[model samples]
Target: MRRGLKISLVTLTGAALTLSASACGGKKAETGGGGDDKKTLKVGLAFDIGGRGDQSFNDSAAAGLDRVKKDLNIQTEEISAKPDEPDADKESRLRLLATKGYNPIIGVGFAYTNSINKVAKAFPNTKFLVVDADQCKVEGTNVLGACFSEEQGSFLVGAAAALKSKTGTIGFIGGVNVPLIHKFQAGYEAGAKAAKPGIKVLPAKYLTEPPNFDGFKNPALGTEAAKGQLDKNADVIYHAAGGAGIGVINTVGAAKKLAIGVDSDQYNLPAVAPVKEQILTSMVKRVDLSVFDFVESVSKGTFQAGTKKYDLSNDGVGYATSGGKVDDIKAKLDQFKADIVSGKIKVPTK
Candidate 1:
């Protein structure tokens, strides 16, 4: 029934888009200027790490673009960043999009901070949105920074692991040893101990450090990390690693252990169909929401520059229960979510 409801909603959304387009002379048009000026809106996306098919972060962003194209009848261009690509390369990618008259080009990950910063200055009239990058540092610019509270969602999943662990030990695999990933680690550790005092949370491991972002794309590294943790008697494991997380899920499923997914509802992904049962839950970061919201704002000509944040109260971050594997713990997770939103519980980002 839930799946049917979701499909119905999507159908309605598409119908609304079609209706709107028909009202505008058979196709929706961008109207940035006043008085009878009609132009087609073109948006561009620069994906992070594993790109669109990784079934994770990049896929989430792609979902947003798909919605914008269908609902708003907008044109979009998407490009993927190379593994360990330099800032200059990223800048060039954004620049290419802007030169082609794509307004409001977006960068999908924090790694694009330098690139977006550089490119935004070059294209003053073009609006830019950088996901997961610090907006405070870019305070006086024509760019918008869209940030999320990943720690809050990670905490919920971490607590779930503690309640469900048979061995009373769990593990975490991070994509990089940066502060962003650390926010995930800190919240997981805190929530595990909060749920079950004295429970053993295994040490966290990072596949690589900054300037070497292969960790986000290397499944081999993720599999290796998960194996090490599983060998240490961890019954459940969670990963904030991007594309590499695919390997983690595969490894855990092959071993018949539980694994937590990140960024998206990974259990629903076709790439993980064979091991769907292994995903206990996922820390859904809502990148799709952020991307879609920005596109909507641009379309309405209310596009604002500066920072925008997504958090627990805004449905920005939370855990997924797609496989019904976490049904027994649903009530407990709900309480945690309310507590975080109501300020009774403060999930750490450090």
Candidate 2:
């Protein structure tokens, strides 16, 4: 179970009020001592846009940090990226955490690739981890790149969409036009074609172009894009957008059509509880596992540099079966997964 944003408001004199909020971006409450042998570990997480309550990508990363605090008894600090902030802001965020002695700092998205590389080189002793980026593959560097085979997971959900669609038309919506989201689109198209060669998949829709990443956070954009696809008779749609994907699900579900989620199981997410039944499945990218494993390695004194890959073989990415929506086709989806894992079917990432 993942946690969402928690807000609290306090009343003051004369109808004035104060608001104190705690969430993934908040400083975690310190835990008790471990012992003389247990060295206190401090982790810093820089969340991508949409932050914790996103119910998708960022929340998955936060789940990893939550586990680190619980199992390792460590102090953690989290900072979120602001909408359309400059690269300097990201650098400053990383440097601030490093200066505060947060070792093995993590940047939760590919947007931090350059920032992590620059910061890790300066602070050679403090390790860094960047999700969805492979810039840390240089030898002797103190940074680890956690990359996932997102296309493989997207492939499974794409096949599910093809198998379940009654109208023979499916669609894809991406938050950004970046290469990362391209992988999702490519795999989805490939999988859908493999399942039903005659199935009609609409042209991929993107909410925003590069350098304007509001696509990942803007629900209104998602709503508009999804409505447009629905108007075209797309009965099944898959979205790789982050928080914006909520709009895609809501619009599709309200139309009595099916939608596929990404990153986390949207069916179980509190954000989409109203439309749980409409979510056919999710491309579950295990960002939480990758983040937790990196921190665990650091804690165990076995942290290593270079890229660590997650794919169907290691449960790094796959399709979710929440809401029993995909249960009827689980065997077929599993077969597709097995074929990909066994190198019989290669998923595209372009």
Candidate 3:
């Protein structure tokens, strides 16, 4: 379900030879236009730390690029960010794509907020999209922010966890202690409390603090965090960690406990095949839809600059029931979703 008001696309000028970097790699799709057409509409994506193989956040964004390649038949370039890389590297990545004539370049995570702002200003004609960041909301800028109501989705999954918890105790694992991930923590706690007033939600465990984003990519950290929670008798655990959440799912599955995923549907991901049955549900954040819609807008000459919010009202975020584990509780979850959408329930973001 695409949602947005279409407007005319802005024309961009200039193009340069492609460049490569040691910290990041590029994957170019040859589906769209070729040659030196100034209006080729090439899409560029700068992925977060975990990149495409995480089967999580980055992969969700990749799904959108894949759709653009297939449906729009447009050329696209993808670049992955290295863990803990300096902010300067992000700017360089975006600039490289812009120089290579990739219009409507997308910075996939909040980490690229500053980089996108700086680079978008330099390439005034090139349109830019930054995901998960609201700071890119500068007036008259070429950058458009694609932000999500992650708390709304997390709240639904938290309620699911509480309803399914046999021990009346659930846990949450976050990749980093940043405010973005905090939204997941806050909503999860709130929903769990709302669903089961006496349910015990262990203190949210963070794999790492600020600056050490390895928590988003390190499976070992996720495994360790899940172990601690399970040792405390947590029968169900939900993680907002990126690639690391894979470890949490695997560990919880092996222990015969339930695990919840984030971003994409983990139960359907081949990467998590061994423990798919253990995944109760996932907070499905529609990064894929957002990315695809933005690129489609650019290609169709209807690109708009500013922030677009994806939330329950628009079906932008929700929980996945891929394993039939949450089927019995779907009605309750939908009711909660309705309440949230109707303003009867306010899920906290902090």
lDDT tens readout by residue for model 1, 22-93: 225534454222112243466778888777787788888888988988787776767776767688888877
Q: lDDT per residue, candidate 3, 1-350, as tens digits?
A: 11111111121234332322112334543322222223446678888887878889988998898898877776667767777989998887788777767777899999888888888888888888888875425333577899899999999999999999999999999999998999999999999998999999999999999889989988899999999999999999999999888889999999999999999888877667888899999999999999998877765556677899999899889889787999999999999999999999999999
Q: What is the C-alpha RMSD of each candidate to the true structure, in Å?
A: 6.7, 7.0, 8.3
lDDT of each: 0.81, 0.83, 0.83
Between candidates 1 and 3, the one scoring higher on lDDT is 3
| lDDT for 295 (candidate 1) | 77
Instruction: Write one digit per residue (lDDT tens) for candidate 2, span 16-56.
Output: 11111122233332221112123345677888988888889
TM-score of 2: 0.89
TM-score of 1: 0.89
Count of steric clashes across candidates, in order = 0, 0, 2
Quote each prediction's TM-score: 0.89, 0.89, 0.88
Superposed by TM-score, candidate 3 places the C-alpha of residue 108 at a distance from the truth, in angstroms, of 0.7
- Residue runs of model 2 more than 4 Å from their true location after superposition: 1-38, 134-140
Q: Tell me how far the alpha carbon of residue 169 in candidate 2 is from the true structure, in angstroms, after superposition.
A: 0.2
**Residue 312 of candidate 2: its Cα lDDT?**
96
